[model samples]
Target: MAAPLDLDQLQTFIAIADTGSFTRAADEVFRTQSAVSMQMRRLEERVGKQLFEKEGRTNRLTEDGERLLAYARRMMRLNREALSALDDNRLEGSIRIGTPDDYADRFLPEIMARFSRSNPRVELSVLCEPTVNLVELIRRGQLDIAIVTHDDEKSPSEVVRREPLLWVTSANHMVHEEQVLPLAVGRPTCLWRQATLDALDRVEREHRILFTSWSATVIIASVLAGLAVAVLPECALRPGMRVLTESEGFPPLPDGRIGILRGHSSQPEIVEALARHIAESLDNISLPAPEDTASFDFAAMNLAVRGRRHKPGQMAGW
Candidate 1:
């Protein structure tokens, strides 16, 4: 009989697939690179197929690996659910999570859904705010955990991922061609806003803020309506937006680092659980391709806008 697949190995496989790098996968799974490699070798031997192909310095999933990825995710999800169901000491506590509006839309639902399934008794109070404010809230013990963008590598928070900051504009609008560039910006405390201003200043590019709001929905709307261009994290680039490259007369903005900050260390178990879920969920979010020109759904955008407008302080909750 074939050797049975191990859930641990399958989990590592999913991590490798999500991160696209064995080194990053090792970091995510808390294993050494050699150990991860050995596990993959053992897994492939058990399956009787090579699962990965070398592509430059990165590992690309082979046909067998691609087929196994879906099964691995499903199995892992079930495994987690089974474990949670079997645990006697179910986690119960109120967790205050703060995140930027843009990230809230993309990552909050999955994190909350998974966390809710695992800890049904837990109540989550989510706050959507700028990273600067989130940091302050976490410091003041108003928030149990917060995900923020950091430009420094030496920050005390746990770095989740690093992505480029892009100049975003409406696909149908030629806002970049204007004499004085119109901009949709976040508050002054926002890192994206500061970075956008700094980059433009360095290039001596003339620009004016046409719209300013803490709500990402408003910023996105301004861009979508062809009212202004905005600087945003690459992951926040929706379907209707076009990314302005450095070659297109836009200076390169600094990369944005997404990290998690913990408030009080009292609820270590609950905080750690939520943090792990956030990190894993973030890993699974696929970024838009640079050349993708897909038309965004206006219905979804309108809903998001309304959601942001009504609940300015809160992005999502369960």
Candidate 2:
């Protein structure tokens, strides 16, 4: 007879795959590293195949391991759903959320307000961080949910939305008949920054970066004054600023998408509700919509960036 599979061991295997480190996996399941490894070893034994491989001391799920990882994810998700269905009266705790700077400034409050009104008993704490930082926070359990832009190369995990990344320059920028505009943008670590550069590189476009700033407003204002062109989400644009659609050799930026990422937990009700609430909020947000002659409201709450203490339009003391 085949040995019985401990669902818990499967979870351990999946967690290690998800986190890429036994230490992080252990933290996710509240076990020691040694304990997590033991569970993974037992799981591999039961399945009769090697589940993970190492690269110079770094762990990665093997091909067979990856297939099992998907199964484990599904099984865990279903099991969590079953438990949630059986525990309808057990959701009374707080859930912490995170978002990006632009999103926090533009769209998070309303989402939180809606979640609060509908589930008054469940306290929600919201924080904002960059996409890179937010993912780390989520994996560390510092946040229960977040709205961020994590495109293909940037995302080794699940994504919630795939929003477009656009180039914005000062309305007054000096447009030469044959010169690439000087650019102002956030730091190199930003997904927007990377995507913008990648797009430019892929197209063999020639442009000089003039400056980098953490503040979207600064970038926009600089561009507004014609200091440089910056790539930003269209939602970040206020009235009167225009995006350049006819750059000489540059096609519209491609492939960067806004998305959400999460994993299964014993606390599933809050996750699902919050996820729905976020999606609904995103659905209702009024972005400048896409248009041939006009920009449409493209605001989708779940697809936007947000942060803690975000005041709809700007961060205080920013």
TM-score of each: 0.76, 0.57
Point out the worst 10-residue segment of candidate 1 by lDDT.
309-318
Alpha-carbon deviation at 243 in model 2, angstroms: 1.1
lDDT tens readout by residue for model 2, 91-209 = 67788777777777777777777666556668877776777787778787777777777545654544434445566544433542227657777777786776777777887777788
Q: Assess each prediction's global lDDT (C-alpha) against the native.
A: 0.77, 0.64
Tell me the tens digit of each residue's lDDT in model 1 across 27-134: 999999999999999999888999989899888889899879867876887788679867988788788999988889977888899889888888999999888788
Clashes of each: 0, 27
Candidate 2 lDDT for residue 62: 86
Q: Which stretches of candidate 2 lie over 4 Å from their true place?
A: 1-91, 153-158, 175-180, 202-204, 247-249, 263-266, 288-318
Report the number of the highest-TM-score candidate: 1
Q: After aligning candidate 1 to the native by TM-score, how far in Å is the CA of 55 from where it should be? A: 10
